[model samples]
Target chain A: MAARKSSQSHSGGLELLFSNQRKHKVSIPSTSDATTGQPSNVAFLIKWLCDNLMRDPRKEMFVLDDTARPGILVLINDADWELEGEEKYELQAGDEVVFVSTLHGG
Target chain B: MNGFSGTDHQVHNLKQQIAATETQLHSLKLQLQQAEQQAEAARHLSEAYQGGFPAEWMDETLVALQQDVTRDIAQKVRQEGGFEGAPSVRDAAQPRRWPLEKHEYKRYGRQLIMPEVGLHGQLRLKNARVLIVGVGGLGCPAAAYLAGAGVGTLGLMDGDTVEESNLHRQIAHSTARVDMNKTQSAMEYLQSLNPHVNYNRHEFHLTPQKAIQIFEQYDLVLDCTDHPTSRYLISDACILTGKTLVSASALKTEGQLIVLNNPPRPPGDALGGPCYRCIFPKPPPAESVLSCGEGGILGPVVGVMGVLQALEAIKVLTARAQRPANGGDWSTNGATSEAAPKATLLMFSTYNTPQFRSVRLRSRRADCAACSAQSTISRQSLTSGSLDYVAFCGATAPINLLPPASRVTATDFSRLPRDGSNVLIDVRDETQYAICALRGSVNVPWTGSADTWLERALASGLSFGGGRQHFVMCRFGNDSQLAAKAVMERTQTPVAVKDVKGGFKSWRDEVDPSWPDY
Candidate 1:
């Protein structure tokens, strides 16, 4: 199976789930979706993270309906994921994907 | 025998010499340690107490004198410029003065030497009028830096009192001022830090009616509040009053900051900066929201954001407040420039290897409810008290999820037996449960994504015996109601579920007086 490496970081209380470690390196088996004959992308990476990196039992907080949650903002290469193809964008080797929740306390 | 005796004598003499030398070395070592400590004391004694005076008198006397000096500075500001609740001096009794003073050049000499901030740039800083809303963690440090830099006017607005819990992150308040109003306490500190900057104090909370009039008096606005309702309210007010906004928020180990309305223009102008709504179109779910008290915050994490706010405010003001070098009443008004600030969200996380991250943000959205051509928010609706921000933000109020029949008093719940038949489920989060809990209580947080917590408990061999009761408790009383209702629905077999009214608070008052309040 082909695999690719990506760096993922979480912040704003989202890190509480991932063993409280903010940054991690994950190698995803490229094209986990052999059934659909689809290339590896953000959706594939998220499922890989949920299965591997999520130390907490409640997966619903980080992923809502199989994508990054509503309040969380995703950045792909320092640009908003919305500008990219969102979950459909194909993952490139050594890409930096960040997820952050909006903070409302001071 | 003679030879043996002679050898023994020689060895005994050598041993005595070694023992004497070792004792001497130890005493010398002790003397060295005393010298290290006494050297500092020796110097202080010569300067302070060599003349037959008590050792503690100098420090105590100096601190008391310093208090008097700070008190005088605050009194001077109150007498001359006035303070909290004092009406602003709109119609100047004297003509506005704009000339840079000799003392000002000396005070700002460090920054004035920079090419970016020479005489003219310094003048711009001296001419800017900035309004800061919510004088707490973000405001304290921001105000200190701004007042030190000689901002022409600094207006402070807040309606909170200082608490023992606030001292760690909110640096402006003092231990002595625990119950004092936040604005008044912060004002005293700022007045002493820089007496030159004009201080305007509005001791009340920022309301829709007061916001427009207060914001109209200043050129720039800073949203330092800790709640989403205030964030929405402040942004709407800034949009209405045509003031540029620098907003920031910090919680737990992270913080976010952005600049809005850099060149605050009319609605529908795509070139203008985006307000908070344009970016965060929907607030987070009400149940998910957590305060700094509920969710712990690092002091330096918030401090970094607050200091950055001061830096951004200064850069925006100095760049935008410039005027014709000639002389035409330039000091009497706000900045004349209309430059747009770059739209980027600056994120800071304490635990990340790269602690700072910046993301390019999109401009104003066409369908934004507050700042669009077909906008629903207007000055009339805002000031006329028509906006129900509390409901819109899902407000931080006590949620009534169940009726009285389902809830029992904490005293009544205390009467239950301690056997395994009666279950006491404490729905507080894990952090709080670690802090303190009753002897026979179990914790399953009501706020988490554990919808099947009850089912999991049943499958794990927890019993709900016949005629036994299930008591639900939480920090206050709201979460217990929700937990009790969920337990009622989750269980297939009929069981008695009751919420402990007032939760731990009433339990402390009515049952155990020694329970830790925090």
Candidate 2:
């Protein structure tokens, strides 16, 4: 697995761990300064997480509805998407979204 | 006879030697034992303090160093033609002082233009130096609104980096900002939001020296930081500087706002006027309360409070007269002076039943270390020797006597058995599951409330009542844990339930992060 970044104490408790299973970086179109390659649009982010980043729903890592977006954890900085909004949340260019599997421990 | 005499002498000599040898041996053993103990203690201390930098490591490092770079920026900007942004000064007062932009007049803008605010109020805001200590959930919205409302110059102070987990409610940042410094990231966003407003970024912790120095420069201070240490520091700094403070918080659905000013003023006809300490003199135990980060909050919930803060800041700048006091306690409600004073306190509840209240805050505590210090240097000195205020405020201590579990990373996580032992059961999504997971146990992907999950688990015959225990887990171990705890409270079940320390990630490293470090 690729090394993931750990959340610091003072920054609240947000740990960003991405799936090391994929070797390639998925490109999400930048809506904010298009020339800057930064993704500022929330809709684009949802599409990116659902289509490119999310794995097959049938897989352990991918556990969202087959017709819907894959089960992904959207952390705005370190907060969860469920508490805020799902993919509908507006994203600035420099913010981060960590993709994790929803299969959870059994 | 001669033989008898020789025997007695020999016996006496042998006894003396034996006694001397015994004393020597005892002293040597004691010294050896003490040396061993010291070595053991040193080794343990090293283990306890050693580690990869925490997510807030940068923040901590900034605190450890000296030199208030943030203060320097504020002072420099204060002296050298204001922040690089929109024209700040307005007309009427200092002519040719600077080109003053006349704020476009609007109706019910009474709050914006009351006599106090007139042209002078706008200038105070324009010339004001406000330092926001954190840019997380509370800090993010507070700072953003402050900038948008045109609080002339804003100082963003936070030593933390953005993380993916914070995306939930920290709207200030986006996914791209992960691993970036929060203060710098926020500053960039604030500047973009309002090009005309000048913003200063303090990519360091709020040391007393820095806090006092910066506090001295600013007209008011806003406490949006999360931790107790920072809260106390902000409070102390404000009192010492005689500046107003707009402190706000939102944990889960409940939110609070307190406005404190130096030289505490009585609640004339106004709503509530109380210092931050009046409501909470000292920081509460960390475990006694849960933060929005740990407790979970709705997005708009915080947004509401953030906007209110802007209103309060504007109110202070605009109010013309004292509020006419009604026959009510100002502490529970906000000040209602028809003539709002230049300094006041305002607090509210955004979620559930929304209530607007203000109180008259008590003046500086004669013994307040932050304020009321005879010597400025003495006040500055207190911050360094001050016990880690966060910990001293009881934020660091674990609530449970069972022992506060230490946090370990996925790299260091070691899984244990799941045979219904002393562990807590966490059943949340896999993504959350990956970052923090308990080893060798039942993993049920349970989302939603406890009532929903419990009813389903029971109807499904999951046998949660079995010898095996369950401790529900979620990110920050908030909702699920609360659900589980609530279930236990209502049912009084005999199940050994305990929320994993720091939830899953905490458990993974401290208990067993290896279960699956995603």
Candidate 3:
């Protein structure tokens, strides 16, 4: 995990917060966009999450998956992802993305 | 005239008077007929009320009165005054009385003022029949609001008994009714809230046989249940019976709401909104599933969803009454008579920057097994026991895979020596560990890794001279199984490691009665 963190540069990277409800609760520090230049869109953020945070990226899926899995919901900067062009919406500085899973029992 | 005789003049005058009297007699006869018809309608209405003026009776009465009553008078009344301003045609119409007592009006006065709900919509609410599947956190609030809103009939279905631990979120159940069956407890609470609502208590688990039959009686179903199997069952039953389903689920600090299988406009034009299967396609893997008992949940999160469920149910029930002109707006209209209900999913979170989000859901799936045009599920299939919802949802407890030697029943564990040589590790989180645990168990709290904790325990010098024996347990046995397996594989020392079968639940059942289950 330390090696992976150091492998990526710290300059002009996104700050990501994973909810405690998720299996991974660690807050990512200065996560650089692997696909494009700094300050990318939601699509690149998802790609970065898949590469870094998820324990088993091959098996685990995210809210952005095309199938629209039942349990998870995603919001971009206090607005519904649907209203913000979903994956196509570009991430701005100080943007907050939230993922909530409604799978557990009441 | 001068040529005619005086007697001929007298006869002409008499003929004119006779014609005038005959016209007056015809008018009197017409008035009498109208009076008689009104008398007959009044009699029917009185008899209908005596028999508990049913919804069908109201429909029949509306048709009859509309046909027989003079439309001229009704039209004149409407022109003179609207429904709210003064007594309109609707007030004069016997069928539109809605049977709400004066106090009922006073009670729901605030709701009655909303244009979308007025007298007509309130009547629909009083006529609605809603079934709430679970009486836990979600069902408690949903049922309460529906009852408070004066929904005519409310069905409470739950097999479990109330527990003290549930009082935090299950607001409908009181500490006094701790041991009572959930449905019975909820019914008591709802009845107290509003005695006018007809409470139906289903004190048994929902089965396929009962699901369709019970669902058939209700206009809508609220899937307030937590289990995935019950969710599938309720959705399928709603699809088969043509009942709207307002399904909500909450977990941890987030919740979801969706209205599924709302009856289509024009009846059978096409399959209604998407069923749960269309949205999920399949249930999440069993290993990933967690209950509130296993994964702690906040009270207000489920409360918010429950309240929303009630709102959606009200929207579905009163939709036709509030139907707008121009075929109604699907986006804003709660219930509409024209277009398909807009399928949308609402998601809410109470943690990490609270957010509420909604996304438009896809239309009904042509290949949806439960609600499609050529769907496999049907009333016949449901009643014949052809559809195994539990199997479909993968809700049955998964088979334990560890070898028999690697597991010990709580009864056997109780008999094992409690000497310091034997180490019992409670793998539940710290919050749960603080709740209660075995007398000598140490808390490790499974966090996907056992090496750090195992090394710490080894360095503590708690092990005996001989090989050490370790037992791992959780609130339920599932997590402990994995923890125990990890301990066995990772430990360098020769240790006999086994998971406590059924975890603390089995211990409470077979080992000790005083231990707290939650």
Candidate 4:
């Protein structure tokens, strides 16, 4: 089976749900983008992360429908995902992604 | 005689040797390139191992690579023939002249031996003035490490008093110190850790007018405060005073850390590191903010982040110390240096397999309101108390969404009939509801959102006082009010639904002080 790879890490307490594996070398099948119906992009990445990574029962913390829940900042290669067209940005090999929830409790 | 006069025979022999050596050199270069590639792979594999287990279900090449890496790392653990002994410190023998006090060598010897922090770096730490704001969970641990490291002048600023709840995470403050001013309690603990360092206690909250003045006295500031308003104020003050800021926050199982104003570039300078405003641009909504009491925090989760703040502070301070005071090409903002730290945010999740992550951050924004070239903030406005941080961040005023008469005082609540005819809906989440609640109260949890518990209960033929009275309660009155409003709107029949003002907090205060507050 053909697979495309991208790495992602979780922070801001989202890790507790993803089997506590902050970084995962995900293997996405050579499938069409879940949203765009084209090549796999971050939209596919989000769905893929939610389906594969989450080990905890609380899936609502990291995901909401097709995109990451609000307040979780996604960085594509150290740049805000928003600057890179949010989930529409095409997935590239070796893309370093970070999903961060800005925690305020001290 | 003619042949002996020129030495052409010896020159020819030398040329022949060079031709042979050149062919050998080409092979050696090819071998070196292959070795470099193997080393790169080994390094990547080691990093993966450090993060956690490698994906075993990868392709054949990756599986083979993992085995190779495992073997390579095992070989490194043991040197040829036997395990290598620890390397001796470079200055095992005392120098003729010593700058640090005699005891200081023994005090900081472990860290002093590090190459990054040698004799010169120790002196910088000894001279550095650091101000830690908010002597709570984050500040308590941060102050401890900074003090232990012997930062010459450590100033702790916090107006809060230590309480029993803080003892779990505020490591520096003991049970005996509870009720004492946080700064004073921490100062006592920090002084015990390192008597050589000076400690200053500013037992007052930081205001817009006082922030810059207090910051002016220090070279670096640690923002351990729990709120967005203080965070913004601290960054602005740091940028205004040209002092570096190391900030951290943690909640539940996750934490975030960032170093702001590292170059301490004067305000209006685009070369400076991004200020808090530059990165966040806007504060999180006031209603979204949650205190440690409301959200709950893990002890080590915040402790680790605070420790990272101290580490980042050490990195910044020591690097600055190693450079020359004035003439240094490597120590400029916006300059390229291999050692220059990329603007990044470090995130940690205690429950995650690889708990730490570093995300590269953009430099100062071109239009930041605090640090950009077109910044609106000025020292004049800050010192004169003209800047309204609360207004800017949108202070969490009391939740006044409901009209009067819908809310009842805690005293009024206790006086109500408990004949089991009236329903007391505990609106807090399940965990809290299990902790403590009014006797015979029904649990219909509210998660700060539109809860379906009321609808579910109503549809299941559960009588809400049979259309007489339904009471809503939460840990705090805020959520209860929201829940009460939801109930009033959801019900078809006109029913009396009143939110107990101040919820259980006021219940403990006005009615029964013995009720568990946590």
Candidate 5:
């Protein structure tokens, strides 16, 4: 039921997708608006994640401040965020944003 | 009538002078034609012999003619200009020869046959001096490939010693070299592979004071280091020293490669390629970072990135040394002047469909603190140790959430009852537990939920009677603390939960000498 609600919201609001490899999965809100009632962008979406999904937002043990984190690659509609103006790239209806981490040992 | 007669006499004298000049011009033309024939014959002879004939026995006249033709052809080519589009005639005329021994040719014959990397490119490779920062998973394969390609000099820098755990992905180090200095171990392996390569070993760790000085000695720098501090340090050092950096990083099943701070073609007319800071101005919070030991990585994923790093390094080194011969499409662009080298970032994911993607990176920022003309991170600044890379990248604070009472040292934990009355939970991953584990210990991998496992264990009557304590452990005691906290939070009944201090590493060092360390 939660998965269906999140999928239905994908057509209405910004479709946020995590790379399947991520450790945790959270249900996206069905409404088209951000939790703060502001237009959803990358920074606001990150805040939404921390406030709603994370176990402890104060400790931020699960996720760091995504805006400043260097290792996480953000893709906007399959293009690099760097090409899409990074965090400044505004989210549109049905816009898909994907986040993947690049910080692991080689 | 007297003036007309004087004019006629003057005209007759002028005609006689012109006749004498014409005769001289005709004779000079004949001589020029003979010289042209001689030069043409010499060129034909040279082309036919193809340098097989000994120069000492050749006619003096023929040698002079051959030299003249070469000079004239080179001059004409120069006059035409913009041969950046064409296969350089000068390059083709004087075929580059590898200055090394015959054995080197046999050693790198496979690489030499590639049209992009012919004799000229091989010679360039032989002249390259590359510095590989870390002799870990990424550095091992990169250094191996560079050595096999006959890179003239390799500088390996690492302070850590090889461990049995490193043998899985750090392929350059073998089981025999366990406990040996990583730099020394890697050098021994590389030297065995190619004795001709000059190995420069830096046994000390990379500090800003030493990074700039060491980077200045090498033509290219490879950021194979895992930590963010080392990544920023290598990028800054390469920028300050005017050396190209081929940086590669792999984590889990993903890897990334980027060539940073590549010097502009004309050198300093415009800015060089983007430095690491231009893209990643700051590092992620230290709490979010995880090493391969903690996160785990596929060996081949890192190997793929390492191999790509070597490939990019070869391209940069060869392109810098000589223009690509044989009209090779190695040219990144057609424009000659004001063409800043393009920076590209490559991302590879081995999961799912196994995808490799490349994105064009932005050019060097005019205000970039490291690589720009008026930047702040100068060689002097680095040498003075004013730029603290570790502090800049935020030091990883010691993970000490639980109080001292909730944690027990390895020495104390070793003395605990090994009988079935007490339960010891090893929180390391299955792979690590398979390697080596203590007796009478149950394996519970440190995942998101410790409560689920604890509930199952309690229901199964593993923790049966009174006075039984649950002790959690991990590789280095970090994850064990988290596990202990999780269990403490979830248990409703009166139960004692404590983590082993310093994990199994400390156990191996302080408690038992026989336990094999990863």
Candidate 6:
């Protein structure tokens, strides 16, 4: 059997804080945009969230934690980030990166 | 000789007076008949109000009245205090369209092209009444699609409140309605999505006793419920009542949907042919089934099953498809297939491929208590009588369900001020800021997200400190509560935040109506 470890066991507080797995997409200016007042895209937004909002900053395009969906289920239009390598979700100037939790209902 | 000739002139004068008096009497009779017709029109409105609408609907009417923004502005603000600065009818300049309309089914449109649901079927869909059991994942999307299809009456049965977790899949509740009644909140959302639909929210739980009452009201019942016991109970009730039951369930990238028709004859036929029990009698042991809570389910899996359930319901309600022939038969190939063992049940398991499965559901079990009386073990004759099946289904179990809180308009907040310390927040778009605003509250309008409001609020140099007791409010209570929750999170403030129940409309209804409610 594959080793199973619950990701939520470590950071319960963070889980409680970001428990609303609702998809809220926020587009903010990048650091250059923040410092120089410029518009930010997915790349800059991803970096800013990691530095400010996320507790652990991994060099990934999307942040996946137990706080929201099961894993960091990232959607870039029609592709899943999990299918790509970690942090490999490429961001173009006009690309939209939607970070959704993997929660299912039947 | 001159005195005798003057008599003819006197006779002409008498005839003129008699003609004028007759005209006056005719006019009076006409006035009385017109007055009676006016009185009859008023009586119809009163009768419709008393007959169709129940007493509990007072809240809905009060909410609607409070949200009235048909009045003028400046005088309204002075009387009502701060305007929420939201757009009213004047801004949109769009005329208010009445909700009630007798629409003939439009043919030659997009729906007519669909082979399965054509013009004839569309008319049936319009008149169909589908009762949805839950408002969770499967229920939310399915109901939305069904409403969009122009179903006349959509009945939502849920006694649960909205929680933060439901926000993930239950897209019906907005952030503004963080803690409102789920049934009421979902109904409002569904109406806004499609004004033509007439929906009623059953705030009470679907108990066995209540089941008979509610299920009998709808043409079809969809079993979107979770637990096995509840599913079995629903199946049994559908059998007894002779209502078409559209049953669907999904979990973890898998789903299943089945349409159970009551007997072979008309619903209330003498012989209650084969029911869900005539096929599978006893409830499967509890351990065999797992819920989304234990084994996670894919969100799309539920979406897929729910859509199928809705389609099946649309079909059954319009009488396009005949009831299941014999016990659990679902063969669309031909009626002669009834003899084939391979053609009985219709099942879909998303585990492998999204193909429908056909299986033969065996005959009535001899020991099955529902169908088998003397041949089976009589539950009444047993030492330890069968447990209350309803209770076994957790009829008394607390629904640990949650959605978001309710949003009150400014009017609702005024009435409930005595209940607790409450404050209002305005969340209108900035472009319409010149219109009006609520005074003594914060303005965080949804200028696009957490940052826009924060930037604008910080730039204003306003004081939002001291962890003040506050409730978020909006024009219609749609966006304010969402903004408030987001604000509470960003501020790291543990505040007892709630949406002003009903937004500015409630405020206008209870306090001052001079304010525009648009």
Candidate 1: Cα lDDT at B365: 73
CA lDDT, every model vs. true structure: 0.77, 0.51, 0.69, 0.76, 0.71, 0.53
* Poorest lDDT segment (10 consecutive residues) of candidate 4 chain B: B88-97
Worst 10 residues of 6 chain B by lDDT: B92-101
Fill in the DockQ of model 3: 0.27
lDDT of 6 by residue, B332-354 (tens): 32224333121133444454333
Candidate number 2, chain A TM-score? 0.42
> Residues B317-436, candidate 3, lDDT per residue (tens digit)?
766532334685232244435544447878776643336767666556667777776677777887888888778766546548589999999999889887776888888887888888
- DockQ of each candidate relative to the true complex: 0.35, 0.01, 0.27, 0.25, 0.32, 0.07
Q: lDDT by residue for model 2 over B373-475, one digit each (tens)?
A: 3323245454565535655565443333222232223223235354445344456655565665446544555533445556655664455565655555554
lDDT of 1 by residue, B1-518 (tens): 99999999999999989977775665455445444434444455456445654444334333333343344444434444334355434322221122356698789999877866655556668768998898888988888899998899999989999998888988888999899999899988888888998999889898877778889999899988888888889999998887889999998888999989766767776656788888777776665677788787888888888889988998887666323357532221243334333368999877666788889776787888888787899998888889877788786678787778888898988887677677888888878899999987877777443355565456645555577788889988878887788777776788788899999999999999999977
Model 5 regions lying over 4 Å from their true place: A1-40, A47-68, A92-96, B1-105, B264-270, B321-342, B397-404, B414-425, B429-468, B483-495, B508-516
Ranking of all predicted structures according to lDDT, beginning with the best and ending with the worst: 1, 4, 5, 3, 6, 2
Superposition error at B219 for model 5 (Å): 1.4
Best by DockQ: 1
Pairs in clash, predicted candidate 1: none
* Model 2 CAPRI quality: incorrect
TM-score of predicted chain A against the true chain A, for each candidate: 0.92, 0.42, 0.54, 0.88, 0.53, 0.37
Which window of 10 residues has the lowest lDDT sum in candidate 1 chain B?
Answer: B90-99
Which one wins on TM-score? 1
User: Scoring model 5 with DockQ, what do you get?
Assistant: 0.32
Query: What is the number of backbone collisions in each predicted candidate, taken in the order shown?
Result: 0, 82, 1, 2, 1, 45
What are the TM-scores, per candidate, against the unseen true structure? 0.74, 0.48, 0.70, 0.73, 0.70, 0.42
List candidate 1 stretches off by more than 4 Å.
Answer: A1-5, A17-21, A24-70, A85-88, B1-98, B321-342, B402-405, B415-423, B444-447, B450-452, B455-461, B466-468
